[model samples]
Target chain A: MQREVMFAGFGGQGILLIGNILAHTAMEEGYEVAWVPSYGPEMRGGTAYCLVVISDRPIGSPIIRNPMHLVAMNHPSLEKFAPMVKPNGVVVINSSLIHIGSDRDDVDELLVPANDIANDLGSIKVANIVALGAFVARSKIVDFEVLRKCVQEQFSSKEKLIPINMAALEEGKKVAQIK
Target chain B: MGKILMKGNEAIGEAAIRAGCLNYFAYPITPQSEVAEYLSRRMPEVGGVFLQAESEIAVGNMLFGAAGCGARVFTTSSSPGISLMSEAISYISSAQLPVVFVNIVRGGPGLGGILPSQADYFQATKGGGHGDYRLLVMAPASIQEAVEMVMTAFPLAEKYRNPVMILGDGLIGQMMEPVEFPEHLRTEPSNKDDWATNGMDTRKSSKPNLVKTLFLNAEKLEEHNVILKAKYDRMKREEVRYEPYNTDTDYQALIVSFGTMSRVCRTVIDDLKAEGFETAMIRPQTLFPFPEEPIKQAALKESCKVIISIELNMGQMVEDVERSVQGGRPVHWYGKAGGDVPTPEEIIDVIKSFVS
Candidate 1:
């Protein structure tokens, strides 16, 4: 079986970073993985996106036109990629930045206030992690314990920052649990 | 260590180190600048030299100088930068030195946008430089394969005393994937000391070695060209590499593709099989020493009716495919050339149309 996740947002939203984390998690789980980024001239504040492909078999193409899931951190990303997600796929919207819904009932759409959740836990930078937590909790594409360990390893160098990030993750997971 | 997740660009940098290549002279260009970004710091820590040359021209000449001195050297660039280095490439080939050049190709006729492209197929497999010379070119589809190729390239270059290029598209350079480097089994060419200008004291013989591309006499130049032709012919006889997919099954159509484009074709083949359509593919691992015989035989399969050459370029590799098939099968070409890779769905549609 194979599943792909497209993470889209404006640059500086750590869209690529979270995609890296997911790919890393999948690798740790012994799944074949590939992370493809749309690397254009945009370094900051411009559109940034990445796709992570996880598979039980060797991955053939890292490029995907219709991904299995999407984590849209901004409204433009939502409008651009939401419709392209496959049926029964989970669409996670960062409700903190995007006020509108995906308006599609064919799939599971989880509205997550990631930035707000991160801010309540002390920093808005962990907002991507919050969205990641929500996505993983809903899709179960990866084990939550494995993801938690992956997140811990991601911030292992910065020991003090791990708690707030952990708190943001839990808060996001809580949102996925609702409705 | 176990497998580490790394970007293709950085993995290539480390692969060079593992292969015992010490000198890296390069100019940065996108979708591949990360190699320089990676090696800049890592090289010093490993006691290797990493020089950011003023231009691709300087980088190429620097490779010539270092490789002449018997040091393993390499440089990475996208399309236009490679063009700047082409002059030096030809000179190095004429001088008969071992060096490695990597082209993480971006779309181009000139200064094209920085995105994945295979348009450099002709520029690489054919001589980009103005000479009767060819680079031993290997195109890698995945980061792991890229690392293996980079490591193998040094030995291959040294063995033939010719430039070897690791040709990858922008995606191979920009994407991140897991890689475990093969053990360093690369040994210095047994004959490098015989011709390299490493200094009289370092050589068994006392004569000073000279490295020059200029053979002013026409007869001498003709002899040089003949020797180069012999080496290329030897390469064709020995180094052709290709992977045939789904050919075990009776298939109606065959595809000839390389690099990133081949991976997309593989997906199309798999999807078509589920719908009960049988197709086969020949994924060329070596662009030079083009797998003419394998493709020729695959096209003659009783079940195969049409042959296709799919690429990211408009139709560069198609010529090679047609020449290989020799009109035994109807060869078709399908591609796009504006930095946009054709999707698997689009390819499937094309393949279905071809089959019918």
Candidate 2:
């Protein structure tokens, strides 16, 4: 199965990092993956996005026009990419910042209060990771264990922060499981 | 071999290091600046020389100086920066020095934008400077291919004793993919005792070597040109690299493209195949010593009704495609310049016009 996921938010929200971590995890799972960033002047405070394509076969084009999944971390991102998600695909949104819900009835929408969950876990910065956890849990694109490994590997540089991020992942998974 | 994900620019830097190229000098430019940035920290760790020259001109000369002294040296730049390095590149070509350079080409006429574009197709394959010369230009489609080609570039440069270029666009430089540094592609620099000017006393023959392009004598200059011509011909004969897809079967249209643009075409070809439209593709791995034979054969296929050349520039590579097609059939061109990369759907729309 081929899964193309787009992660979008502001630059400082670690949107690109989530894409990278997912790419790494997918590759580790023996899938071909490509991560492409939307790079330009708009990357400052404006909307930043990265596309991650994970496929069992060799990936052809890294540029995804309509992704199978959308992870929107902010209002702008949700508004921008929500409609572009393919019908019968998955849309995971951070409801803490995005008040408007997706109108599409064909796709599955899993709304997680990512910031609130991350804050409850201690830090709000890992909200992206929380969204990622929610994504994997609801979509089942990757296993919870694989997502955990990805979180550990990504935060390996700052060992102290690994535990909190892992906690964020757990919180995200719990909320997603209920949905 | 474990698969590690890395960006194309950083992978190129790592590949150069793995290939045992210990000298790097370059000026930063967007879409390709990461190569220099990665090497800045990496070269020091590997005991290699890394310098951010004051300008691209200075970087080109630094490459010339190091290459003359028998160092495996290289540099990276985008379109405008590459223009600045053309003079030194021509000199290196004339002097028969082995240097490797990567142009992660961006859009141009002049400082166009930082986004990916294959505008440097003419500048790279054709002689950019004022001389008859060719850089064995390699264009890699994906990050892994970029890594492998970069590793192979060093040995090819030394074997031919000519400047070798890896021509990529912003997509190839920015996209992240899984890559492995194969042990076999790792090569040591050949001993340059014969011609390198690494202190004349270091040679067993006790002879001094002067590396310069200034052959004032008419006969000597003619002889040098003849030698370079022979090398280029040999490269054409032996080093033409390309990949063809769905060419074995009869197809309605043949699409010729290179670098990252070809990947999108591949996806479109698959889509067209599913939709019952016969389509084939030819992706050139080497832009210089271009795979003209394969392209011509693909274009000449009996079922092919139209030949389309897709590029990121305003049809720069299409000229070469036309020459390869040799007017046997109509050659069409479609492209978007100044940092706009066309989507598979966009290319599909173009292909539809050809068939319909």
Candidate 3:
């Protein structure tokens, strides 16, 4: 199986982190994965993004033109990448900040109030994880348990932050399933 | 070793450490600055030397001094920085010093933008510096290959006593993938005791070993050129490497490409096969040798109709492809330059025109 995902957001929103987490989980599952970030000067405070391609076979190009999934964490991301999602693919949007909606009807849209959900869980930094959990729940691209374990390993240095991020993940999954 | 998720730039640093490279002097440039950044922290831990030179010019001279001592030394740069180092590179070649340098190429000509590009094809294959010299250029298509190429480059450089280059695009440096450094490929620290200028105490002979490139006599310079040409001749005979896909079948057309562009062509050929059109592709793993014989043999296949070159540069490797075929069949080119990378669909569109 092959899945290409584009995660896009503002520079400080952990867009690249989410993509990296997903790629690590896929690698743990014995799949070949590639993660390519938008490099150069524009990456400082601009629309930071990354493309993750996971496959059972060898990957050809790391550049993704039309991704099977797009996780947009802000309004401009939604405006830029929503139209590029493949037909019958999934577009997961953070509903808290994005006031506009994707006009495409052929693709599936999973709207998660990631920022609100993380704020309710007492931290805004976990919103990217919330969006990631919702994308996992909706698309079933990778096992949720593997993703959680990867996140835990990433933050193993800080033991206290793990529980809240785990809670935020569950909250996002619950919201995604209800929608 | 186990698999580790690594960016291409960081992997090059780690691989150099594994390969027993102790001295690294470089000037930072876009798309490849991470190589220097990663080594700055890593070199100290391994008890190696890592210095950020004032400029590419100074870095080139530093590399010359380090390598002349028979040390395994290397540097990384992009197109413009590589251009600045060409003067010292020629001197290093004439002195027969073994140094490995990596060029994560960007868009060229002048101070170009920091994006993935293959516009340095001619600069790499043909000598970018003055005089008669050639660098053993290896272009890798994947992150794993990039790591392997960096590991093997040290030995190859020392064996030939000539400079070696790893030519990759910005995409290869920016992309992240799973990689493992093979233990067998990790070489012991190179033995520079033979001709190294470690002073009179370390020398076995009473006479001093002079390490100069100047040959004031025209006959002496001609003799040096003949020796360099002989070494290059051996490299071509033994080290030319290329991979052929679907050439076993009676393919209709052949596509010639190298580096990341060759990976995209793999997908294009697969799609064409699914559509009941069989094609072949030749991916040159070593760009300096140019893999001319393989391209000629593939073009001579009775079923082969046309040969096309798809590149990221505006028809740089295309000239090499045409020369390889030697007018045996029609050779065409489809490419773009100045930071624009061609998509697989774009390559497919061009291949479809050839089909009709």
lDDT of 1 by residue, B119-150 (tens): 99999998889989999999998999999999
Docking class of 2: high
Report the lDDT tens digits of candidate 2 across residue range A48-95. 999999999988878777999999999999888989999988899899
After the best TM-score superposition of candidate 2, give how far the Cα of residue B260 lies from its true spot, in angstroms: 0.8
Q: Which candidate is the best by DockQ?
A: 1
lDDT score, candidate 2, position A130? 94
- Which residue runs of candidate 3 sit more than 4 Å off their true CA positions? B184-191
Q: Which pairs, if any, clash in model 2? A: none
The better candidate by lDDT, 1 or 3, is 1
lDDT of 3 by residue, B1-356 (tens): 67888999999998888888988999999999999999999999989999999999999999999888777899999999999999999999999889999999998779878888899999988999999999999999999999989988899998888899999988899889999987653443355666567676765667676678999999999999999999999999988988898899888889998888888888888878888888899999899878999999999999999899988888989898999999999999988786657778888889779756
Clashes of each: 0, 0, 0
lDDT tens string, model 2, B70-129?
888999999999999999999999888899999999887887888989999999999898
Docking class of 1: high
* Candidates 1 and 2, the one with greater DockQ: 1
Predictions in order: lDDT? 0.91, 0.90, 0.89
Fnat of each prediction? 0.74, 0.72, 0.59
> What is the CAPRI rating of model 3's predicted complex?
medium
